[model samples]
Target: MTTTPRIAIIGAGPAGLLCARVLQLRGIEVTVYDADTAVDSRDPGGTLDLHADSGQIALEDAGLLAAFSELARPEGQAKSRLDQHGTVLSSFVPEEGDLAAPEIDRGQLRIMLDQHVRPATVRWGHKLLSATSLGGGQHRVEFANGHSATVDLLIGADGAWSRVRPLLSEAVPQYSGVSFLDVRFDEVDRRHPGIAALVGDGHVFANDGDGRAIIAQRNSEGRVRGYLGLRTELDWAASAGVDLADTASVRRYLLAEYAGWAPELLPLITDSDGEYVNRPIHTLPAPLTWRHRPGVTLIGDAAHLMSPFGGFGANLAMLDGAELARAIAEEPSTDAAITRYESVMLPRSGELAVQANQAIARFFAPGQAPAPDHEAEHRRYQEGAAAYRR
Candidate 1:
């Protein structure tokens, strides 16, 4: 009888959960650790448009494609571009049967993946505090709650601030010089018809010549998730007295900044439902690569964290999980699996990271328009999406 390997996966996010699911299918014993107390401890944020090549393919590999299909919103694939004055610049609605990419709420995707994995596979409230090599192809992981576990293989899917990364590389994520003030409007269609019309069915991306802009998307339950982006220094936000936790204060600050902009864009800021979330964009250095170490590896944000400008972070993470799982299942030895996974993933993620950096530089630069040439930008996005699919 072949001895199954004992694997430890950090984080219960999509990458970690999907990795655990695939490994369990291969009869490997896996334990997933997450900091949250429960599956639904905190809201997992907004919706995601899972591209056919990356996110969708990863789900198919894990045997969750059908589950993802059931939860995906096809009608939410539409996109609209506008200026701050509310004039529609361009729009695209994929024809039926065009499975280019479909939108799924982040919460729904989580639930779908959660149901497919075995219960108790994930130990919640297990905040990872540190990890140390035990020598001879084993490692010890310490948790914040005075608990620890030893495993033969450790997979770090813990995301941007991962503890597992230091074991393999000395790199850290740096700010992208852009900050987003996230706002939301509930029951937008019913309560705020004008704003709802501005957003339409899918996403509304609008920008002005100035350094300020907005990207709003129609979320599940008639909620509109909007991001008011600004190109400013990292300390600029802190010095402005903009209370990130207070919605009213954020609204006031936004209005004051965009005082001369059109009123149509103001409602997205003023009529928000929840506290503003101040997201300071960060990314790993371009072409980030690490030396491979035996018995340890990384996936998802722990590997290549980049700006959302290219909208590939989650999709790439899911793909990394699937690829890593395949490597381990097919390899004859643990060391071989880690070696193959790193060899392929490093170059692939590095390419995407470079593209993400270019996108950020162009989109958020001063005096630049968000996706200046709509047709050209769409074509570029489609080409990248196609390459990933192929």
Candidate 2:
């Protein structure tokens, strides 16, 4: 612990980037490797709300909160809950200038995080293959294309199928019995007016009161992303003759399942502006932990992956990055730092994972009850509506 340690982070994701950025600011040298060919190799995913206590704090620690605010959409916090018939059950509109949990497109957030890190800090296309412990608190990292690096510390931020995880735990990601068809529309205000009106200012969550669900969120620049969710086997689409590559066929297949829903919600699937892609939800087992090993650790989805049902995935990842970086920068010994990081992070993430898994199950549960606090929320909404009317 007397000498400076060479840290290697396997992933250029939000967690990995923020971790490396914080370390750099503290005069620590770190290298980040990612499988991505470039920053914009593909759409990073959907819109995400950076919670104040977690993701926002991470940006503040990394000196990027001001920059984040410039790109964030505060109005995107507007949320509406709906039933299968597309009737708004309740709505929550944020006060003007509320920043408690503003939303940003995932791609834009990634780009903002990327801009803050030092140039060449991330080596793209360095797809991780394996990590071998060299003993005496050292390890070697191997990449897919014959690249390798030996470092004093290795951090796994590589996500669900992390190559760096096996060195720390025997756990692997498991499918959560739900899948989604990701669809998006561009120039939504002009091209899809009805859908835009349905989505309103921010996001919409419409449940069938059974197992099916739809989540659509408004991203920056009038782009809206929608997920058509179903609880089914991993291969259900393939076996059900849903050909993802054929737009018309995919639309027909999805519409068949949603036949009884409101006509207003049909465009979310039929009017998708791009090709539909399938995403099977996956997560690590809840209440997971591993004995600490010197010179190795994990953060984000690499550690405690869970269902997006709880909407805590990205927030937890960024929080993990910021807290772990702080521990390393302050603790006197590497062992002490890892211990401190795990002590707080493990229990916290494990509990959230359990809650997230439960939320996912409840979302798919037959005839599930409204959220426990829905009655209170409904009253608040009624009061707000009356105030607006007055």
Candidate 3:
């Protein structure tokens, strides 16, 4: 467009922050609104491997790639496949200088992006309440903090339960019947040598095709994150009379489900250093696309939420933000830019979403045949998108 537009991004996540940063670099002014009261108002989760193509490219665009590289752990590319008995079935140890995809804490990446953005770029604690269209490619957003703004373009970088998405599509995230209880071990090499040995440099995923699995990922500073996956209903904990708020109760329930698992691996359930969080996997329909509503669009999970089995969520979200920002800076109109962004983003995220569905089914299928080699199949899944190599 010939005239500069008032752009508002609703979210402070990878998609929103990266979009705002790239927009500023392109000489476009934008504002990001988030519900967070402060930066540290979160308990950081585990580390994730960002790919060369999608995530790295976005960080490069924002000029934070070198800094990200400094904080990244390249050796974290090493991964292993194991059985319930804790036998290391197979492993992939990254070669020297192999920087295909390196791991970093999710909190670190978010903080880096937050720090690089211009001051006052993000309006924190502004929980989005609703978006009312002004017609003709414009919208007025209302926040729960008694704030409001009308902008030429409104971008929904918000996550799975985005309020902005109601204007575009009727799709809601559906439960995938897989739930994860997140556990962590801290001061590990010293306090928890056994768990550290099992995790090694990267990840150890143990599955015996019995509809349950454990994924252990090595984080920086001798910390480890484990996801105890169970193929059960969303309300399984409640139905089993396990009060999640009670740590001992949660442990008892999980340990019972894993009765036959290797005694050595049981530490993942009982010996965690702290809190146990239950995250139920959910996804929007694959190939989720809207009818090109003018002046408004979505990015990241708000646009194409999928199962996290293939490590696509954060990577896709960053790519979406970067590409959408570029489109807005180049296209002639808000509608045109949105159209351009959705055209490419939809098909790509859709493909990955389908692959994620297959992965979940293969692992969670009842008495299904043993899934293929873990790292090798993961490489196949990342072939065109997030694939990494030396």
**Tens digits of per-residue lDDT for model 1, 333-364:** 88888988888888988998898878877766
Please provide, for model 2 over 1-390, each residue's C-alpha lDDT reduced to its tens digit, 9 standing for 90 to 100: 355888999998999999988988888888999999988897899888877667887898899999999999888878888889978787888776567678888899888888888999999999998899999779999998999999988999999999999999999999999999999999999999998998888889888977798889998888899999998999987899878789988888888889899988889988888899999999899989999999999999999999997567898899899888888888887778889999999998999899899888888888744643433533443454345335
Error of 3 at 168 (Å): 0.4
Position 249, candidate 2: lDDT: 87
Q: What Cα-based lDDT does every candidate model obtain?
A: 0.82, 0.87, 0.87
Ranking by lDDT: 3, 2, 1
- What lDDT tens digits, residue by residue, belong to model 3 across residues 1-390? 567999999999988999999999999999999999866688768997888768888888888889999899998988888888877777788767767689999888899899989999999999999998999989999999899999999999999999999989999999999999999999989999989998888988887678899999999888999999999999998899999999999998888899899987888888999888999999999977778888899999998888877788898899899999999999888888999999999999999888887788787776544544545544543574444322
Give the lDDT of residue 125 in candidate 1.
97
| Separate clash counts for every candidate | 0, 0, 0
TM-score: which candidate is best?
3
What local lDDT score does residue 251 receive in model 1, on the 0 to 100 scale? Answer: 76
Among the numbered candidates, top lDDT falls to 3
Off by over 4 Å in 2: 371-390
Higher-lDDT candidate of 2 and 3: 3
- The 10 consecutive residues of candidate 3 with the worst lDDT sum are 381-390
- Flag clash pairs in model 2: none
Instruction: Quote the positional error of residue 61 for candidate 3 in Å.
Output: 1.4
